[model samples]
Target: MPLSPKPDLSIIVPLLNEQTELPDLFQTLADQKDILFELLLCDGGSTDTTRQIAVELGGENSFTTQLLDTPPGRGRQMNAGAAVARADMLLFLHADSRFEAPDTLSIALQYLTSRQSVSTHPVAARFRLHFRRRTTHPSLAFYFYEAKACLSSEDCIRGDQGYMLSRSCFEDIGRFDDSLPFLEDLRLAKTIARQGSWLLLPVRITTSARRFETEGLLRRQIVNAVIVNAVAVGWNEFFRELPGLYRCHTETGKLLLFPLLDGIRILLASFTPDQRRTFWQATGRHVAANSWQIFFWLDARHAFHSSLPPESVRLQWTNRFNRYCAPFVCSSPVAWVASAAVRLWHRAMLLLCRRLEPVTKTS
Candidate 1:
């Protein structure tokens, strides 16, 4: 089959041992209408028949499909896929995700181009996620996951959210951090958010929750929360402890320790001058977002699991917190000092980044 000079999108999937999952993914991609796309499967040394299944699926489909080989690891496989992708836009999807709508790609591209027209910089986005199966009646864990995706904040976009971005913007951010064994996608989202708007599209991509089921839903959420926090704090050491800490019997996983926190200490003192400068910039960006989030969260259960207006819910909660904390937490001298210190740190990082920007640009 002849290929376009540039496809509208290149869907990159990093496959390991997903023989059974390939056909459904390929079929779903095949069903996409009114859009041009190339599906590139980066096989990471699959011992199963995943490669054979992929090849057969490609032969059966009208769309362009390629089964490429790579070293075992999602980061390496995705980077390898990106290296050869022939599209101006790229989407890194997991093997277990599938587009339920026939026009999902077309709709997603329209959303991207529409947003791009209004923004001065490149736009990246991800679909809201839906689990393929519900494990029991319903769990608060599911609601929390849904809320995290729906939140207007860019930081909440996770790997399973179906990342989509133009190739140029992707390249500018230097692509995914292939160095990490995990949380590469989360880190990539942060980098993209820094550059421009990171959108969470209303369109939903259903993904397998088999891992959550196997690992235990609550336990998986705990593990995820830990891993995400570790990435944010750049605590490489904590991550080393994760695979074992959360290792399921088939499953299982804080703040205020910053001075002693391995990640924070490394950021402040252990890094080289250049590394420290990068850390400072990242720190400033992070703290600004983090500080807002401290106030953004509401204590009410309805705030997280409701169909009510998000702002209205947040505003009411904020009023309640201010009324309560003002007479207690904020009244104490120790509390005042701690709060002021945090505020000062955020301001200091901002000014430091401003001072360093010129030197970084010229260098």
Candidate 2:
């Protein structure tokens, strides 16, 4: 068939080693739910069967899928795919992500022609994720997150939430930063945010929770936190020196962190919602628990300090944690005074300790 005039939209999906999930993903697209659009799938080198699966799904002459070879890195692959898009709108989609509504492209096209997009930062749209559960229904928070994902703009996005951007908008913000290994989504968002209002439509897109299921929510959350914190400080710099940050250096650290996290989970279980409300009302935001597993820290006077013995450390820490968290819990001026006092005490002790300990010469 001869090439036609450029399509209205191109769904650019970047894939790498997604063999386990790629087929179902393509099948969703193959439904021709959005016939007016083109599918541009860019595959990075996959040691797994992902590329083969994609080829099979798309078939030799499938008018829908356009498979291309691109380098690894989600941002890099997406940028490469977007560059070749013949459509006026370029939607960056993940291989595992699925649209909850029918004709995803049809819904997105409506946004493209609208004047509402012009004044928006980065000028974008995204749908929410609805994970396919084989045995059970979706979780409470999952639905909430999915609901929020649809309406939140770049400032309020998670990477996996599907992004629909105009080709003009993509070019206006410059392409995704190919150099970033992680947190590339936020970098793209920041760039786009500088240009126009970050907009999230009410439409939802369902995506697999496989990453969290495979990696565990707590572990992934910690990793995400480290990445976000690192990006916030500066792009592409190591912040592993921060004790709370997670690093992939060793399985050994995870072994230790797991028990500490378990302790935290168990303690949280002990609180009734009403009791938790009372505790939270009494203590406030600064009431917390994270440093317990760090082997290097041992300051009793520190904010993280607990005089309770090692055997009772976990239990005691929980009590202290619930005690100090205030503003949301109590919202009292007394708590504010107490919070100020703690900060002053901490600063004074640090200064006093430094002055008292004479500097020693180092060879």
Candidate 3:
């Protein structure tokens, strides 16, 4: 199995304590057919045998493999991997990501290449994500998320979906933001949306749902929403002060949301009146921008009930809200109202978590 002199794609995966995940991930890479790709395993100072496992597995893989040592940040690790890639195209994937189809990579590259050839502007691609959970039970939350990932909406194109773009396009978008340890993927996704266009590739990528499973699904989503909201409102201090609030997936357990909510409240209290008002206003605008989710949820609900795919039902209500309602909701007065609603919702969630935590622990 001779590697291509110049691989068709460079697959960059940021790793950290992924010793357990390496063999399966390596096997998936090895299974990729009809596509020549170089694997760059960017290690972020893993204390485990992650680097060693990557090296040993790389030796058996058909494609070219390189292990890079970088500081402990996903953005930095991915950027380092991209720096020395041999291919014109780059695919960024998580270590937990797996492909059911051997031709997944081949199809994705062909689709992207074909789209780029036809379109005047640059096109970036992300796979439709399917969460491989431990349970087989139906969950509306998971269904809604799966549906949402299929959209080109803001904050929808996550790293778990596996981003694919040409090296030139990536360069134009600039390096993944290393300013924070989180939201780097969201930042890059937003930039790509602004500069070019995002295509939801035909192939589906299965990513582990360990985080959501370990830390109650609804609870984890609430935390994620809070984080995204904080980012939206430019609450930099929230992240700076509560740096340990977001932990690694493997380290996650039954998430206690009360402490995090309390910390946020404390941070809010510390702000001046003007700054507080501005923060609330920004939060309102962010909420209004994502108001389409409510309508999309309605669609997802319909799909869920019918046992149909998420995108099966096209609801024009979301479009109507975006065109007519979003502007009005973006105003300061509406924003203030939105802010109040959010505060009330947070209080409700705090109470609910308090009631549920004991039961969860005992059960």
Candidate 4:
């Protein structure tokens, strides 16, 4: 494939240890011979021979390929690739992402071209996304996320969908925030939402769900919800701490318990409102019985503190306790009893505390 005098789009893939996935990714891009685009593979210091393979694949495919080196961060890598890119449009892709159909790039270009012809302002586009190799009957979590993205219009977007933006728009939105440890994609989407309109293309892209599989899908979703809420609520400290917490949990093999915990969450979620209320009361009793152990662990963990924001702390502790309590709650018939007992104890305790409150005296 010969290079065009001026490529219409520049495809930048930021990669790290993507040796196994690079072949399929590059092959997918190379198959789109009709799409005028330049391929830029920005390597984030991969110890594997990904760089060498990228070079070989580029030569075999005969597309304009430029291999770039950058520090190991997705934002920095993409920015580095974009700095040297020559196309008027930039499409950022993850190594494991693939076009859902052969016409994806062409359709994307048509949208951009049509938008540019009519509008004076810069335009951006993102494709609909689905997890690759999903079952015919996907999980509830899958539907939950996909529906949320579509319903949201443009407020939320997963990076795997691929972000296509004109050079002007990319610069105007201030580009991707490199300093963020993660969620740079969503951050960019939020910025784009504020700056201009987002073109939600009907075309879809398939992204790898390896992480969700390795870590329980539901647990990952819950974690994502907590982090997204943290970002929404301006609790930046909690957001910053999440990476460390994830690392700690992974090293300790705590992630193995996520599937079980998530299963219990699903089971509890399936209950009717009235049934849930009854279960919660039982859960309270169970908690009260283990109050001493809970207190000891909290003391050891230094979980109670006045300095940290109360809401943030509460959110973290609630999730942590749920993980530990899920196993007990999964036992036959015990969860119902625990929830009822716990609810009753909680009400009594609240009533006593309210009764003991001091009254103000007027002069």
Highest TM-score: give the candidate number. 3
lDDT of 3 by residue, 1-363 (tens): 874599999999999888889999999999999998999999888888998888899898778899998877899999999999999999999999999999999999999999999987768999988899998998888988888898877578899999999999999879799999978999999999998899989889999998888998888888899899988877888888887878877677989887787677677888899998888778877777677789878888888888987656566667777778877876877777878888788788768766765432210
Model 2: CA > 4 A from native = 60-62, 116-122, 147-153, 239-363
TM-score of each: 0.71, 0.64, 0.93, 0.66
Model 2, global lDDT: 0.58
Could you tell me the TM-score of candidate 4? 0.66
Model 3 RMSD, rounded to 1 decimal: 3.2
Q: Is candidate 1 or candidate 4 better by TM-score?
A: 1
What are the per-model C-alpha RMSD values against the true structure? 10.8, 14.6, 3.2, 17.1
Query: For residues 295-337, could you state the per-residue lDDT of candidate 2 as single tens digits?
Result: 1122222222433321122333434444554223334554455
Candidate 1 regions off by >4 Å?
Answer: 1-5, 134-136, 239-363
Candidate 4 at residue 174, lDDT? 95
For candidate 4, write residues 1-363 as lDDT tens digits: 774578889999998878889999987887774678899999988878899999888888767888999987789999999999999899999999888577789988888778877876667788776676545654444533443344334545768879998888899889889876567898898888777767777777778777676666755655664455445534454534334434312233323333323333444566689866655654444444443334333432332233321112233443465577645654646655655654465456445534553322211
Clashes of each: 1, 18, 0, 15
Candidate scoring better on lDDT of 2 and 3: 3
lDDT of 1 by residue, 313-341 (tens): 44455456456553454233534454456
